[model samples]
Target: PFPSVALVGYTNAGKSTLFNRLTGAEVMAKDLLFATLDTTQRTIRLPQGRPAIIADTVGFVSDLPHELVESFRATLEEVGEADLILHVRDIASPDSAAQAKDVEAVLEQIPTPDGKTRRILEVWNKIDLLEPETRETVVGQAERLAREGTAAAVSAWTGEGIEALRDTIASLIDDDPETQLTVEPHRGDLLAWLYANGRVTGRETDDDGRVHLTVRLHPAALGRLERLYPDVID
Candidate 1:
């Protein structure tokens, strides 16, 4: 299956803008805080030719209201279920570090199913708003962090460094090995499940209705399938 990525950050940090820029979708990307109250997801192609699901979530804030957190459980859960978390930051903002702390505080409260920490990549966004010298310095720093597989700098508005961000995400997703399986035909439910949970690249049905599938699945999804249909796996 295609990997999932969740975009999370402080309010007005340009997550929506980056989301739109990356997915080419027109979901509202306003300058106002909390403009995106619901989660929006779109299919995007990673730099390495694999597709992925990318979600834009409501913005975070310091001391996030308990009521809102309770109401937005589903949206927040997307962050927990994501294969990768992109912590979008307004690098041009003076309070960027403090805002990042606020985001980190909220992330800690989310539940991860496997009791394992999710991989996070810092996205230092809005470099287009920086001055020439400052942009150079910030971009250089981000590039160094990216080399270590930790961060990327981009201008959601101007498309700066976006390709590099895509590449980074693809590299991270590809770090896992995918599984291959052939299953019996006429199992509509199983076929549908495979399409929904993984990237199905090939499918064929022979005269007897047997199905052969080539799917690219994350390790977790592969494990789930293995448990469910151990006999079918080959």
Candidate 2:
């Protein structure tokens, strides 16, 4: 199992857009409120080539009703269990700062899996909607924040500054180590699983029907593979 990332923000803040941009998922991203009610999970490769689970949860609303919170307890729990929390904000919105405050307020009420609030990285999204001069100012601010390792600025619609955002995520959760493995041709299934779950840097086939691979895998994936193909992994 890979570490999970949860996207959290106020309603209509482009959290869903960023989710789709990062994971290639098709979750609805609309201009209206409450577009996504339930939580959605998707697998994606980090910039460093490690696989991870990315989750998009229902948007946060100021003074959210206790009844609705209770109704979506399961969905909101995903935020608490996340290894990383991305606070997506609509930078172009007039209430962007207030929206961020609201998101933080909701996060405070969550009981995280680790019994503490996870570290949050601000995602200043919707830069595409900014005016030229304003966009330049915002971009500079984002760059400064990124240098401090606190935020990333991006346009989910126009795909601007997305690579930088991905790199930031990769740097945050990149504690996994690389390993080499050798599998027989008959174990094609294993090869496919490795490709899907790990980052395969190189592969070669020998005349003896052996496939050699260099891969970077999360510890959980590495352990599982070792257990399944003990003799194959070096």
Task: For model 2, state the Cα shift of residue 198 in Å.
Answer: 1.5
Model 1 lDDT per residue over 25-112, tens place: 9988877778999999999977535779999999998898777787889999999999899999999999999999999989988888
Error of 1 at 27 (Å): 1.0
What value does the lDDT take at residue 127 in candidate 1?
Answer: 94
Q: What clash count goes with each model? A: 4, 0
For all predicted structures, in order, the TM-scores are 0.78, 0.85
- Predicted structure 1: lDDT: 0.87
Off by over 4 Å in 1: 178-234
Instruction: State, as a TM-score between 0 and 1, how close model 2 is to the true structure.
Output: 0.85
The residue pairs that clash in candidate 2, if any, are none
Each prediction's whole-model lDDT (CA): 0.87, 0.86
Worst 10 residues of 2 by lDDT: 110-119
Highest TM-score: give the candidate number: 2
